[model samples]
Target chain A: MTTTNLPAAATREALGPTLVRLQQNGANIVVVDADLGKSTSARTFRDAFPERFFTFGVAEQNMISAAGGLATLGHTVIASTFAVFAEHAFDQLRMSVAQPKLNVKVVASHGGVSTGEDGASAQSVEDYALFSSLVNFTVCVPADVVEAEAMVAAAVATPGPWYIRTGRPKIPVIYTDGPRFQVGKADMLREGTDVTIVACGLLVERSLRAAEALEASGISARVLNMGTIRPLDVAALEAAAKDTGAIVVAEEHLTHSGLGAMCAQAIAATTQPVPMEFVGVQSRYGESATWDEVLEIMGLTADGVEAAARKVVARKR
Target chain B: MVYGAQSGHIGGSMSSTEILAVLYGRIMRHDPKRPGWVERDRFIMSKGHCTPVQYATLAESGYFPVDELSTFRKKGTRLQGHSVLGKPEGVENSAGALGMGLSFGLGIRLGMRLSNIDAHVYVLMGDGEQDEGQVWEAAMAASHHRVDRLVAIIDRNGIQNDDFTAATMRTEPLDEKYRAFGWEVRAGIDGHNLEAVEEALAWARDVRGKPALVIFDTVKGKGVSFMENNPNFHGAAPSAEQFARAMEELA
Candidate 1:
């Protein structure tokens, strides 16, 4: 089906309210929070659906465990908290929730260094790797507000445990009016043969800009919005490898075991392996920086991605 | 069912047996055949070290055949030492970790509440497990949510893994503590007495505004003479001769 086009203006800041609306429409849905409902833009759900909304009073483990119970009872449970504390529920997410394939959505707000001011301790730079290590977790990092809302709706409706990494800042709109947000499929922005940039979360826009820069330098660059990190789109990765010969994975997480590592492993498991560069935070803690500074320091800026793409192209066969 | 077997947590297990029997026998609305029935009530063995009792009760309740009790704790046997999730049937979550089952029960209960399913979630925790911080977390959340459909039964045999509960970590006035946390507390019943167990459960069933905690003050190894109130048997399976003696006493 040709994707229906939505005006970008309508999608720019639609994530928070849209999620609230979708959840309101679904009777079986409940939102659990760990004292950050307002920051995560879920305060409306708490206010409107007082009975359906549960506040766990800053206890992430209890919140997740309760969500697991709610899921078993057949409720679509959405547990929202900052990304760092959500990691505190990793054991519950793995043992109680994912192992049983319980239908619960762990909506982690303030994901990545974009959280700012709270510094490294609060930022979940390693969340993707942590959740992806589990078997039955669907890790999603939506780049823009529209995708975040769409992904939230999809996550609540989807089966099994979902780890949705959302941000605190209002990101620019990318997919306005429903631009084909398939769970395991990659959103190809620009087709190229020389190099491909695989990215998710806040890095998608930077990757797109990096592609434009590469084109100016006479390089044909491909940009793939890799939303689902756990079930890494191997088919798309393989197609990019066969078509592009060079690839760069950009994420707002540590380079070790996040989307880059999953892509690396998937390509290694396949017969065809492309020259790849992983653009993300190196193994280090976060610091107090503006989103721009954090992106630049963590090598997630457009220039950083462009440089990484150049290296990949240089290493290509 | 396996009366002659040497087993651990016989005291705590016997104390909780009637509670389990009531749940599996009547209180819990679950189907052994379709264990994952969405509308079915959930039961979590929070104090999971007492598997001999759970296996025996499960067998008696026809979750599996009575013959399966013979393979308890043996390697490759479905009857594991702690309750595992992927077992034959009647097991919900893998709950070897202390202070975890209650939280898991809370999750299932919350899920049920969200789905608008009128199913209750029951979790049986050991008196010793009260020391775990997560238990308090779960208790606080359960009470805060006023989960009327959630019931937590503590096996208050006053024994721990190493010694008496007082010697290890006292969790006395357990009823008061849970009440302070917002659970409607009930006590003064013989845990082994089927009639009292049914009565306390009926009370818990009637609760609407708060979670219920039934503290079963039972004797460790109630039926067996030599092992009665013995902390050594908290985790020690008896030898063949000891097992025979215990079985004789129980019979």
Candidate 2:
């Protein structure tokens, strides 16, 4: 295919836009990848700037470790792979690399069960939990294209190593072009007082639909797009618990060690703990089904999220 | 080779001697005095067990006095069997593990590329290190990112710590393996051919859009006749007579 030579201000995919920004900014950004270039959309970078890019065949651990060495010498190395292979670089990522607080960006595409038809082995069901446990690293799961672009830019500019979980599908652009995004702050899409729904990544759209469903039933549900999962929007979470007295956490990963666990543990710190319900894959593997089927199987649909919200609200009563 | 002084990883060191010689003599962009110079290229021995050759090269290159090479393996010397971080001079990463050099080179290459600096990263690995799954991961990664500024030299000595590489675990079709991974693989060159090694180094330095892997068909103990291609010398330092004979051949 011909190269995409879009206008300077034209809209583009998250990875493309972020790469362009890095080019313009003269940032010392490098994209290291496994053999899955077509999947991760890093071919554009290779075509545009051949020198600044590196492909490490399939060595995930060495890729991460090398990224660490590069970061030590003051380069911003962006290592990309499926979330599964990226997770395989755990020991280096946790102890030998990220613990030293290296300035490396691990861009894990095909996050969650979004790699539909590739089966459960390719699907990363525990990526969020795995990355969340790493101290001092920013954990981001942008919901849509706009949010993805913002998160990628923020991740590049953010200090320390950042784990950005992105999906394979072309998600709807939920937020506007300039949707006031930050590293730790939550975006309040719709406000209500009966129940608070905190979601991130692709599930943000589902959570918004769920909130609308609850609204049709005369229930006011506050929706917060918790794009940043690690330095979790704690103030917003506390407000949700205090105002609604009930909360529901939704993501596309495992229920345990995800946003649900964070909200539950955070809310418990308060005197009036809000009853929380988690909506995600309840500790199971996925098959190579379509995206819709996988979501249906894992109960990540709007109706499913709405059901969890209802359960949490009933517990409050 | 220095008798009791060659007490750690002598065979692999001897196998890699010629490659190390060519690098220090002509290929590597290093400054003996200013080891951390910004534009200077880096050499990370990820398969670090074979540091005696590196120490020998460092001594010859004037990074330190050749007389100091005798202190190797002695207590409190900076030159340990495996490379350490605090060693004075051009030593980059403190690598003790296998299959990590390519990754370290990846980082340095990325750094040099990002800053608009003209530099390269060269990493050396052993034939047996191919067993570590992480090596293939790094190989694929380097190809995907197209980090042409990095060069990997594999010392195909055909032996590991114990037995022959083929008898222990075969890594045949080495060049095609790396080529299938998308690297610009060049193999079957003699590691001792200073001219050939120089030409390969020049080509690797100029080639862009792909990392280069040069597989040197090296003997286990290259310079010494008795120990050449012998797996028993892989990690054992030569005795006094053996060292004398090896030095006599070098002379």
Candidate 3:
């Protein structure tokens, strides 16, 4: 049932419709919103299943905690809000949802500086780091609409705590058909041997583009879409490390605690400690700009990823 | 559990004794053998530090062997220092943080409505827990949804961890707050009086359109002489001599 007619759509834009489809199919889904349903697109679900929908009216903490409560009653609870706002409810998530490993899925939108003109406060550069740090959390950031929809379905099929981050701005669709998504598995978008570019979120698109650009310059780079950050595709990572001998991690988050750090840890734990370079926000906050402009400033560009890929490739042992 | 484990919350545990007794013994529709019974009612201890009261109640209610009380706070024991679901059974949800249980109970109430299970959810909280903003948030949401199947009980024991709840945070006019939030309020029931506790609960279970709040006024340490209304026993375990004296007083 995967479609080939692709459009440039925001990952968040896919949440409501996909959620509504799942609910119609008899998924015991209860969506708890914090008054930003229109923006997060939870409104689509509200329009469909008003009775099952709950709005906590800007109380993210209550929404998050109540999702835990509802999940205990055998409902697959999906709580939606902007990424930055979701961070404020980390304690509730830790105490109520994560500690108990409840069936609560926090599908946060407007992740990273891709939120554009909203500036520093609305952007979530630390979400993957924070959510993944929790013991039972499965943090995932899809590359496009198809993956976003599939990711939501996968989360419903699976249990325990899940944090799914989606971007506000519509980005290019990389997958023409939906790809099979396993929790800890990475998808190889492009095969190579010089180096492997491990990236997550919209950075997967950038990393793919970087690989294309790298091929023209005689540097053949492999591209891996690291959608699931926690319980990372260690086997794929190990294979990439063993195959290519170098890795470059790209993400729309902080360089310190996000994708770069996870890949580094994965590589470090193995005997193969490949040379790595990070293409992300340089431990600084993002500014107000167009989505593309802000991402460029934060070094989330294809060219930036290409440069890191080459740099790491050169340092191959 | 405090005396057995040598570490646990005793004051609030002692304070909530009769309330737990009334619910586990007479009220809640539960079978110790069928703790996960779909039709059974729920009890969530929001003031989670009071772990032993509910644990002991569950044991006496036949959820587990009464002798397992000795392993209350030990490592790898299902009887955690805070309330958690399963192991001994009958625990509906894991709760340790204050102000979370009511919202949890609200979810259960709403879910029960969706599934048409027709079971009540009772959330026990501390008076000091009213200071948590999430409590007020839950209070508003419960009334907004008008989930009559959810009953919130506040063990208004007057004292909290360091001192009295009045000394720490003045939660006066508590009934008015619940009323304004559209809850049917039954304030100031004598918590130690088992008959009074049952009467208030019997009334709360039948509330028609709004969620119910039954406030029980009790002392922090109800059964012992020196520990009564004493903040020092909020979490500290008694020495052997002090334990003997407390046992004597109870006898």
Please list the residue runs of candidate 3 whose C-alpha ends up more than 4 Å from where it truly belongs after superposition. Answer: A1-6
Off by over 4 Å in 1: A1-16, A23-27, B1-11, B26-41, B71-80, B84-86, B107-119, B221-232
What is candidate 3's lDDT per residue for A285-315, written digit by digit as tens?
8889999999988878889999888788878
The chain A TM-scores for the candidates, taken one by one, are 0.93, 0.94, 0.97
Ranking by TM-score: 3, 1, 2
> Residue by residue across B29-99, what tens digits does model 2's lDDT show?
88898876888888888788888888889889988888878788788887877876437477776666677
Q: Estimate, for each residue in B9-68, the C-alpha lDDT of model 3 and write its tens digit.
A: 999989999999999888889888887789999998899899888888988989889998
Judging by DockQ against the true structure, name the best candidate.
3
Backbone atom clashes (below 3 Å) for every candidate: 12, 25, 0
TM-score of 2: 0.69
Error of 2 at A53 (Å): 4.3
lDDT by candidate, in order shown: 0.80, 0.80, 0.88
Q: What's the TM-score of each model vs. the native?
A: 0.89, 0.69, 0.97
Q: Rank the candidates by DockQ, best first.
A: 3, 1, 2
Question: Model 2 scores what on Cα lDDT?
Answer: 0.80
Among all windows of 10 consecutive residues in model 3 chain A, the one with the lowest summed lDDT is: A1-10
Number of backbone clashes in candidate 3:
0
- For the predicted complex of model 1, DockQ is 0.60
Interface RMS deviation of candidate 2: 3.0
